[model samples]
Target: MNSKVINEIKIKDGRVLTLVEGDITERNVDVIVNPANSYLQHGGGVASTIVRKEGNIIQEESDKIGFVQVGSSTITSSGILPCKSIIHTVGPRMGEGNENEKLSKAINSCLGLCLRKGFESISIPAISSGIFGFPNDKCAKILVNETISFLKNLEDSSAGIKLVEFCILGKDTLQAFQYEFEKSKPEF
Candidate 1:
């Protein structure tokens, strides 16, 4: 079965922010962002799905990295997955102090890593919205804003990161992201 794209926004710089309803691990982008824990363990949630589908090599590379600070991100080989890399970002737990800020940092960290690696496209899920318990609406807002700002700040899109896709699973989350995307007015 093919995943349907629910929305597509064209950045003023000519890049795209796409919203898709599907399994994120299946996306064939240059990079896939994983909402991981500080320990870099893939025991459950989106992390587990990627590790299981991609192969143990992903986890092995993660083990080598050891730990990632909350709101920080690290990259690992994509293992058997189609993407070139997996960016493991550790977002904040809802009750944690400054949850909003932490989530923003986590996302920015992922984008920065993508720019550094010169990845032309990247796919991300709603980080911290699952077991980490961040509000879905809030997750959507921050993600959309951060991505738009990231693209806007680029000197001239010379870094090569062109597409940023939010791959949401389930109907409710997809709706939340789509709604937020609609409400947000991109700067152009």
Candidate 2:
């Protein structure tokens, strides 16, 4: 983690959390990361949205990566998605994950790729809380915490990212990450 150059730290800067309720599939960000399965193949929910929008090339590119694991990820071009790139991050499966640790890593993987891709801005929907059924609060906590943890200490602080927005679809979720991210380090 770089930790020096600030890209999108909400608490550190003067900005409050940007929680928007809208369709993530159509948002125009540098990259719209997907909460994908290890197979990288699209199935349902957000996964299906990426596949349906990006065309068949997404699955074709994903096939080259083989099966990824929880907390890890892979990337493929968005064949038809509105964004320039599609980062496929495999979030932890419901109950099968290591509670907090693995989820943290998963969040990092997504953020790390954003930097690696030279993208300073990105958008992510709720990961693992839909069909994966991991519970919304826990998912938001892991995502916000791990994202803050990584961005705060990133060595590649020059990732050029100015914003990392979470385009949440519902109010309950918007409140969750906004709350956790507002907490002090040991407040949890």
Candidate 3:
């Protein structure tokens, strides 16, 4: 559960974007996004880890909500986790048509949901980059770029999202995100 910050950048609006190497389930942010399947099943991967650590109430809530569409997101109470809420976002699987666009939409959906709920901080993983077969570097680029775009477009300086973190567990995934973070630093 120990997590460490790998990189961080501050945007003009005073918001912070960070790359962390650790378990997203341990993040104490306002919300932590779960890369989910449409059926809301927490069977394997990060979804399973979150449910195992945070308790089954997360799964129970997801069951009540039923299916969520790809490129969309839904929220549930955080259960025993420190975060206030969990945003389950369905990302596209590789070989799916327009995978890049779908991934972008998924990221945007999570960010938009966070804005609506007034969440000041959120932790997200590299959606679809695991068993779903998304390439790590591409996933990293899309996730980082989409998040920066979302924050920059917000008209209100007090939009409540002061922090956006990419919390990755694997070393390769963390490296990919770190590369993106470095590439995007100057632009921010």
Q: At residue 164, what lDDT does model 3 achieve?
A: 95
Best by TM-score: 3
Residue 64 accuracy (lDDT) in model 2: 89
Q: For candidate 2, write residues 1-188 as lDDT tens digits.
A: 11121122463332222444566767777788888888887888888877886678888888888899888877788877678888888877777847567677777888888887888667888888777877788887777766665655655444356676677766676667666655623311
- Model 3: residues >4 Å from true position, as ranges? none
* Candidate RMSDs in order: 1.1, 6.1, 1.0
TM-score, per-candidate, Cα-based: 0.96, 0.82, 0.97
List where candidate 2 sits over 4 angstroms from the true fold: 1-17, 155-159, 181-188
Candidate 3 residue 57 C-alpha distance from true site, Å: 0.7
lDDT of each: 0.90, 0.71, 0.93
Give candidate 2's error at residue 23 in angstroms: 1.6
Clashes in predicted model 3:
0
Ranking of predictions according to lDDT:
3, 1, 2
Superposed by TM-score, candidate 3 places the C-alpha of residue 96 at a distance from the truth, in angstroms, of 1.4
- lDDT by residue (1-188, candidate 1, tens digit) is 47778888888667888998888888989999999999999999999999989889999999999999998999999988889999999999999799999999999999999998999899999999989989898999999999888887888655578899999996777888999889775655
